[model samples]
Target chain A: MEEQVLIAGFGGQGVLSLGKILCFAGMKKDYNVSWLPSYGPEVRGGTANCQVIVSDQEIASPMFEASTAMLIFNEPSLHKFEEWARPGSAILLNASLIASPLTRQDVRAYYVPASELAEQAGSLQCLNIVMLGAYVAACHTVDEETVQAVLTETFGAKGEAVLQMNLRALDLGKTYIQTQK
Target chain B: MAKILMKGAEAIAEAAIEAGCQAYFGYPITPQNEVPEYFAKRMPKLGRTFLQAESELASINMVYGAASAGVRVMTSSSSPGIALMQEGISYLAASRLPCVIANFMRGGPGLGGIQPSQADYFQATRGGGNGDYYLVVYAPATLQEMCDLTKEAFDVAEQYRLPVMILADGTLGQMMEPVELGNYVPRTKADMTWAATGFQGGKPRSIINSLYIQPEELEERCLAMFDTYREIQAHEIRVEEFHVEGAQLIVGAYGTMARIVKSVIMQLDQAGGPKVGLVRPITLWPFPQEAFAKAAAQESVQAVLSVEMSMGQMVEDIRLAVNGRKPVSFFGRTGGMIPTAKEVREQILALCNGGKE
Candidate 1:
């Protein structure tokens, strides 16, 4: 299977890190993965994005014009990438920040209240983790156990409170999508 | 060891360390800053030298100094920064110093944007520096190839006592992939009888200088270097070929552009379009002329296309290599604009249909 995923948000919103986590988890599952970030002149409030490809076959090019799936966190991202979404693609957006409805009828859209869920789980920093959970649930791109393993290994050094908060955020996102379906 | 995810720049730095790079000196530039940043954190911990030079000039000169002392040294920069170091690079070449230089190129004739580009092809393949010299240049397309070639670059430099270059772009530098780094066995330095270490009682003092007072002496040095260059050209040309045995069109590209062209070839194949092939040059300086010549000699091959991120720099080499065996065409995007797969596919189809794109 081949999954070309694009993640876009503000520079400080962990857009790049979210892509990195997915690639790392994909690697653990023996999938060929690549991550290419938009390293433009982006500041804290500026736009940021990354392209990720996880496939069973070797990836030829990391940059793609169309995405099989997209995780958009802001209105700017939604406006920018809506056209690049391929038909039958999945778009997971942040409902807390993007109030505009998706205009494309060819793709599937999942609206996750990532910011609200992060705050409810105790920190706004884990909003990316919430989106990750929703993406995993909606697309089945990776397994939940592999993601949890990655999170535990990545955040285990930060202390139990931070680790627990992100874990709770992941569950909240997953449950939200599952209940909606 | 198992594979781990690493950015291309960081992976190159680690590969250098694994290949026993003893010193690093470089100034920061966009699209390649991670190279120096990686060295800054890891070099000191490993009891090696990592200095952020005041400028690109100082960085290359420092490299010359360390290489003269028989230490494996490296430095990295982007397009404009590399231009600033041309003089020092020439000096290093003339002195026969073994060192590695990496150019994670960006758009430029001057200080251009910090995006991926192959505009520096002439600057890299032809001597960007002054004097009659050549650097063994490798253009790697993937992160895994980047690491493998980086490790091999140091060995090639030391083997020939000539400078070597890793010519990659910002996209390859910034991208991440799973790569299996080789075991970290520090390389043992070979016996360098000409290194400028402390003089022995009976031996002559080793002098490292590029200048020669007499014209005859300079000519002799140039002739000797050319002999080494001829040996390298004979034995070191590398290329990758795909479905070139009996194809109508053969696409030629290197580095990032190669990856894109390969994808387009696959897409065309899946769609049952014209039969296409690719010849990706791994060694840019050696040019892989033989590979192109042989591929073009096939009776089924009609035309050749050179794809690049610049406005047809490498196409000149392709034409010279083909030597009228097939009509060579060019397709490119410039100023940090990467060509998409659709664009490349269209170009290929146009070429196959006997039309200019």
Candidate 2:
């Protein structure tokens, strides 16, 4: 199986870290993975994006024009990448920030209130993690336990309180998607 | 060692350390800053030298100094910064210093955008420095290859006592992938007898200088270096071939562009389009001339295409390699613009249908 995901948002919105964690999880599952970030001036408070490829076979190119899935966190990101989504692909957008609806009709779109979900879960910082949980639930690219393990490894140093907060955010997202279905 | 996720720049630095890099002297440059950053953090902990030189000029000269002492040394920069070090690079080559220089190239004939680009093709392979000299240039397409070739670059540089370059771009430098950073086997400096270690009583002092006052002596020195270059060309030509047999079109690219072309080939093959092959030059210099000549000679191959991130730099080399055996065409995106797979596929399809442009 192969999945190419493009994640885009504002600079401080954890867009790059979200992609990194996704790739790390892919690596843990014995899959080949690559992450390419958009660097330079554009990443400083401007829109930031990263392309990630996770495949069962060796990946040829880290950058591609189209993606099988996209996680857009802002309106600009939605506008920038909506056309690049492949037919029958999945798009998970942050409903809290991106009020405009998706333009493409060939793909599946998931409107997750990531910021609101994170706010409800205790902090707005876990919005990206909330989107990750939504992506896992909707696309099933990876398992929840694997993501949890990654979160533990990533946030474990910050102590149990922060870890629990992130865990709750993940569950909130996943449960939101589950209840929707 | 198990594979771990690493950025291309960071992985290269780690690989250099594993290959026994004793000193790192470099100035910060975009698309390649992480290289020195990684070295700065890790070098001191390992009791190695990591100096952030004032400029690219100082960095390369520092590299020359450390290398003359028979230590594994390296420096990295982007296109503009590399341009500033051309004089020192030439001197290092003339003095026969073994050092590794990595160019994570970005767009430029000048201070261009900080994006992935292979525009430094000519500057690297043809020598940006004055005089006739060659650097063993490796253009790696993947992070794994980046690490492996980085480790090998040091050995190759030491073996020939010439500078070696790892020609990469910002995409590869910034990208992250799983890599196995092989074991750290300390490189032996025993063979570096020519190093300027210090004078000993009754022993000839080793001198490291690029100057030869007499024209005849300079000519002799250059000819001797050419002999080493010829030896390197004979032994160290690396190329990878994919679906070359009975293919109608063959695309030639290197580094990041090569990977993108590979993806295009795979897509076309899956869709039952015209049979396309790839001839990727792992070593940019010692430019796999024979491989292209052989690929162009195939009866099924009608034309050759050179894909790059530059306007058309590597195309000249491809044409020289093909030598009228096939109609060679060029397609590229310059100034930090990366060509997509769709665009490459369209180029190949146009070639297949229109037959030679």
Candidate 3:
């Protein structure tokens, strides 16, 4: 199965790193994956988005016409990428930041209060990771084990405390998704 | 072996280091700044030299100096920055220095937006620097190919004794994908007999100069360079063909644009509309005319479409290669805008309808 995901938020919301972590998770599973970040002026303080494609086959263009899944962390990201979702695609939104509901009826969407959950879990910086947890739980693109392994690999240098906090943040998001359904 | 996920820019940097390139000199430029950043963090650790030159000119000249001393050296920049280094590039070409230059091209004309663009086609394939010279240009379509070609680039540069260029737009430089990193075998530079090390003992002094004031002597040097270019053209032409069997139309593209075309070809294959194929030129300078000719020679092939990210820069070469055997048409998106697969397919379908311009 192929999943084209767009993870979007403001510049400092860890959008790019979340996409990279997703790519690493997919790679650990031996899937063909690509992560393309919006570089240049758009990434300064404005809405920054990254397109992540994970497939069993070769990924052609990193930029997809319509994404299979989207994780929006803020209102701007929702407005920017909501229309680009493919029919029946899954869109996970941060309900804490985005007050609007989905307009499109064709796709499945989950309102995961990612920012509030991450903030409660310890820090608001793990907001993207929380959204990533929701997407992974919904799509099952990669196993939670794979995500945790990559998280350890990525955050290992930051020491045990930071790594455990982020891991807890992920589990908190995953638990929230499970409770919702 | 398992592959590792890497960004395109960082992959190129790693590939260069793995190829035993010892020195990197470049100014920071958008869309390609990661190249120097990667080297800056890694090269010092590896004991290799990494210098962020004050400007592109100084960078290229530093590359020239390191290369003249028989060290594997490289410098990378985007469009406007590369334009600044053209004079130094010309001198490097004239002096027969072996070095690699990576151009992660962005939108062009002058100081255009820092987005992906293949608009530097002419500036890259045809010498931007004055006089008779050619940079052996390699345009990689995938990040894997980007790493592989970069490793091969250093070898080709030293073998041909000329400056080689990796002609990538910002798309290839910024994107991340799976890359099977190649092993690094330490390069021994013992065979650099002509390098300007020193004239110790009774050894004769070696002079490296591009300036020959006498017209005839300069012409002679150019003719000799042309001989090398001809040899390179004969042996170094590389192209990748996809779905060419019984194809009624051929889509010609390079770099990231070629990947987009490949997706279009896959779409047509699934729809079973027309027999379509792609001819991806890996080596742009040695323009694979033979491959184009062979693809055009297919009995079912009706026309060839040259798809680029520039305003018909490579179409001229496509027309020359097709040589009126088939109607050669052009489709492109300029100024860092990339044409989607759907839009490109529409163009291809229109071309197949009547094989018109």
Candidate 4:
């Protein structure tokens, strides 16, 4: 039950936000989880990332030896983490991201047109959701229901519409992955 | 008691609030910025004093002013910032002001990258700021220890009329885990008495300056401070020993890196005393020197391995603590390239086999 997830992309692509969401969602689901971000200059408009781990046992170190799955919102991340993935590891690539599909196929690779799908969903801001949906599909550590409950709790009193839209994006992702499978 | 996951920097800020700290002076630095942020958002709402100074120099001086006013005060920074605060730190040491300073160490010499590093070992245990006074320094590897030790640092500061430090790394600051928020019994504001509250009728005016006219008097004061330091070393040397009995190797570590070493000890034990042991120095300043020395004296101990985010800072102390009685070895991954327990085990095994490493 040791699931290591990496979310990587450009700085403003909500990489930090997505990682936090998943880390917190795991906590809500009562799992031992941790979120470690790339600190220092690795954050300003350049490559940014965070490692989120959910395990039934105590996390020895907040680092991952083999990232079980990744949500790459850009080409660099795809190229960077692709070499490190183990067999059967998932690489959910956003075709609309900075990088396209040049990744080698020794693992489960999915081409998620997440950016365009997000724009069509009436909110480009929800691209993170599309990628997160891929993560959910690949990892299945937490259900969509749990994610929604966390969103409702996180969005506070004024988050009703946000909660709905985010859920929509998530479902859109589920449908997108479902067709591929 | 309850449980919650807390970062070392966040715990320092929260502990400041609980310790009745009237002011928190600080500047932004990696791995340690959470302390200021936590205070910035919460202190104002709580009606406590909070200031984000322009530089570490300004922050430390602000701490000086706040402390002089007979109020609980705190400031935190990384190695560079601590270097900037050295002058003021020396003054605080000399004046015997009670305050807490947290060092979220990153790799360094100059403008080091933002990652966990214990390279400040010499600077910390030996007094980086300079002067003869000793600070009661605490090195917490866990979030729980960070919070608990922070509050305890304040108490030690006031009790001994000295400065205390929470020496942690960025890993402890940016990581999240389940932590217990148990029954928090904050120390009462009235519990501490050596403050600079203005003198009342008939009460003599209290001075908090570090100036003394007589050289002999100053010397006496210095001697007394050393005596206090020795007493603290004797009474407060805390260490967490793991898998030591009948163990072949002992890895000495502290702070965030120590947790990884803890995991390594478990792995070694499972690998048949790959018979490895651990000595966690929770108090980096006082250091668990006596414990390690005693352990090293045993023939089965073989060699001591020092693991840290720095190249090899704490290793020097380990060697000295062992006093050449045992062969001390070092292995590290700095610049944020921390190694796993397996790597450490490989290094230790190489050493014990008398092979090139």
**Per-model TM against the reference:** 0.98, 0.98, 0.96, 0.92
What are the clashing pairs of model 3?
none
Give candidate 4's iRMS in Å, 1 decimal. 2.2
Calculate DockQ per candidate and list them: 0.87, 0.91, 0.78, 0.48
Give stretches of model 1 more than 4 Å off. B183-191
Q: Return the candidate ranking by DockQ, descending.
A: 2, 1, 3, 4
* Tens-digit lDDT string for candidate 2 (B262-327): 988888888888999999999989899999999989999999999999999989999999999899
Model 2 Cα displacement at B116 (Å)? 1.1
| Worst-scoring 10-residue span by lDDT in model 4 chain B | B182-191
lDDT of 3 by residue, A22-90 (tens): 999988888889998898787456888899999998887777889999998889888888999999999
Using DockQ as the measure, the top candidate is 2
Residue-pair clashes, model 2: 0
True contacts kept of each: 0.84, 0.92, 0.76, 0.47
Model 3 chain B worst lDDT run, 10 consecutive residues: B182-191
Taken over the whole model, the C-alpha lDDT of each candidate is 0.93, 0.92, 0.89, 0.79
Per-residue error (Å), model 2, residue A143: 0.7
Give lDDT: candidate 1, residue B182. 81
TM-score of chain A of each: 0.98, 0.97, 0.97, 0.92
Model 3, B1-357: lDDT tens digits are 578878899999999998988999999999988999999999999999999999999999999999898899999999999999999999999998999999998988899989899998898899999999999999999988988888888888888789999999998889898888766444343356778888777667667889999999999999999998999999999999999878989999999999888988887888888878999999999899988988998899989999999899888998898898988888998898998888898999988888443
Q: How large is the C-alpha RMSD of every model relative to the true structure?
A: 1.4, 1.4, 1.9, 2.6
